[model samples]
Target: MMWKIQLFKLNFDHRERDAVLETVDSGWLTMGERILGFEAAFGDYLGHGARCTAVSNGTAALHMALLALDVGQGDEVIIPALTFVADANAVRMVGARPVLADCASRSDWNVSAESIARKITPRTKAVIVVHYAGFPCDMPAIAALCRERGLKLVEDVAHAPGASIAGQMCGTFGDVGCFSFFSNKNLSIGEGGMVVACDGNLSQRLRYLRSHGMTTLTLDRHKGRAATYDVAEPGLNYRMDEIRAAIGLVQLDKLPAGNLRRKELTERYRRNLAGSPLQMPFDNLSADVVSAYHILPVLLPQACDRMGVIEMLKTAGVQSSIHYLPFSGFTAYREYFTAQDAPLAEEICSRELTMPLYPTMSDREVDLVTGALLGAVA
Candidate 1:
């Protein structure tokens, strides 16, 4: 059913269309100069000598990062249970066990250092931290713990691209920073992803692994820069196409302004929802952090019916979504972890409701959704 307000809308324009059309016209649709330009531009945006390898999607980025780090059989990767299932699946794909961590609370949906510490064991090779809903995780504390325990840190930065914590970018603080450019993300490009690594060697490995372990890209061969290429090792066809890369370059340019707009909308939600029954989530961002403002999820009161609220909103011409169901709560992952493993995650998952938030949403739309929510609960 269509609603007056949508959960999200793509912030595309003729520019994205022109970029894709131009790529098609060039007859270079695979990994090419556009991908390289996107990577270089993203690297500069990431700063701190961060290098990016454009991939097919966010899941590919995470998988490549894990493979590049040699996280394999018998090893365990700890990740928060509150994020999308891809994080846990990536660990499993690498032949590693995923030890689920819990989010702090409904008010703060990110995994705390304490949660990570509890899940860490001798087999824990790394920790994958998701910057849930664009809120930066406590990277400094988590990094310190990883250092103390000699564990690698991988950042699942799908929700955060320009987001910063303590003046440092979210993707740059960890060993490997994986990003997604899904249709609804802050940096949407239809379907694309990137992996950033501070270590040059690791970054090189990621680049090689992104395109089937080829010693050289097809672009090099096409340009006559290389006579032939060799397959160094097994890799996947995870390379980002030229059209998506072109679109990503455009989206990347708009991210800062878009995030500013989201911030304004989020503040409006905070003000409009004040004294209302719904509980707001993740309003405790430190002064030093700049969130991507990817989503606005409020926790419904326990006394209220979650589905009833969503249906009410729909009847009132508003749309809503759930950020996620705890990964451990899913059938595929249940055997690997139990509901009791992350109590807070399970609690938040049941109540969390994502309100419509996007760069193109109008003030009137925001007001409509908020007013509908208020009347629904009332």
Candidate 2:
């Protein structure tokens, strides 16, 4: 089927094409100079002496973060009920139990420190916070809470790259900050991720865990920096190759402008959807935070039929999506992870609708989707 607007359109152009071709032509493909360059560029963007470890994907980043923190069996990691299932999966991959926490409120999709506190147990070893929809979570308070409780904090920053709170980047506030450069993220590199640490030692641990726990990297040996290598520990081969790293470098260069455009389009949608029955999450966010506006998800009225509304939009040549359904709603996770009463996340699941949003999207398209949503709800 065809649609007039897509839920997300790639911002690729000649630059992306040239990047891939150039990387292929270089003949140094496996996590070479390009990976180092991408990591360095990302660290510079998030300043404050941060370092990044490029990984295979966001889930790999999460897995490595957990392994670096030594979160294994007999430990519990708290994660947001509203985020993608990868968070819970990553926890499980490290042999840790995942405690699902509810969002702060109906208007706020981010999991709050209060909600997280409720899920804490004697075995809780870490807290993973998702900056849902590119909105910054109350990290300052969450970080403080984690510190007081002696729990490691990992920032699941897949939806947010340039997002900041009180003049600081979102990923820098936690023990391990994980980011995704998936096809639809604020910064697209098809399939890649980066992990940043609050300090140097943790960052080194992440890098070691990214490869097969080798003392010296293949790149180091290739550049004559090391004669031979030793297995420091058993690690996964979660290294990002040169092609994605090359593309990531280009995407990093374009992120600020792309985020700014998304902010503009998000405001345009808000203005156009004003007074509509649907409610936009983070509508009343504080002035100190800046959003990456990665997605345009809104909640429909309870009385509105979600599938019917989707069909209406489809007939009108508009594309729509759902951010996620609660993990407990799935059959695979039902027995492994017990379901708790998270009214906010459940309510969001029943009515969440994502409208078309992307950097290349125009104001007219925002108006078209908002108008279509109003009509569909009506």
Candidate 3:
């Protein structure tokens, strides 16, 4: 028998197709009712003083957030060394420099607040904290640090849509929270994103920035007597389409249930691997954090060679991957920072392996993956 499993997959059914068809039949295919509905629903879901604006994708959302903050040229934004390059790239897009920081060992691959505090300088304008793999970072400490130093706190919530720390949503605690609705994300729209901010002024500015700096969006333009518009500032076209927003609304409806299932599966993996040489990702109970359980990452012991185990798992028909390899290792950032300066991040990157944990995965698939992992280690 052949074994088949994917690292990531979208769970769309008849309901999604029906919603998309409904959107198509409505005749208005651009940003309109569907986008408004998604924004409202997402704001409610996050449970912060959150006001949401749907965008084209997560990267665009981040870019707009930085732009809205006036973070450009000669400013520095602090970010973790162990995250998707997009987090840092968003800073560069606005002509700002990205300062890399180290992650904490106890928090399981998340940036440390202490490290963030240490990296802050007079030129520091913002701190971008990523909730790595759905694990919420130390928000209280980070938020306090930002407040004290007067630095903008931006959250990269691409991996954690509905995640919370101490009963508060991840995105709400920061100055601006950005989410991804990529097909592989917890709340996917095939491809879309949103920004949540508590500030009304910032929200309005974001609206202007996402739609070509137009005074009104296309939806608003088609509805009223106004025939003329004005561009207040230079902006990018980052508006979300009605089709993607329709899919997003349906996916949002299913998120809570999907998150519960993911949690159950993660707990099962933890129990099954209790005594193994592999170290499961750590959870901080003190913070009362609950992950969306987007991915199950395990760290092999320092003695074990990570790439060798990945190849071994591949031979057994099981797929394994590394979450990141340190942003400094990438050529684009090498001039600003170096791998040698971030030994902890490099070490974590070398030993970390992410196993499959999608909602559609079965018990047998889990068993096969665990067995293969065990064999690789042995």
lDDT per model vs. reference:
0.91, 0.91, 0.86
lDDT of 2 by residue, 109-161 (tens): 89999999999999999999999999999999999999999999999999999
Lowest summed-lDDT stretch of 10 residues in model 1? Answer: 325-334
TM-score of 3: 0.96
Q: Over 4 Å off in model 3, which ranges?
A: 1-3
lDDT digits (tens) for residues 184-236 of candidate 1: 99999888899999999889889888888899988899999999989888888
TM-score head-to-head 1 vs 3, winner: 1
Query: Given candidate 3, what's the lDDT at residue 189?
Result: 84
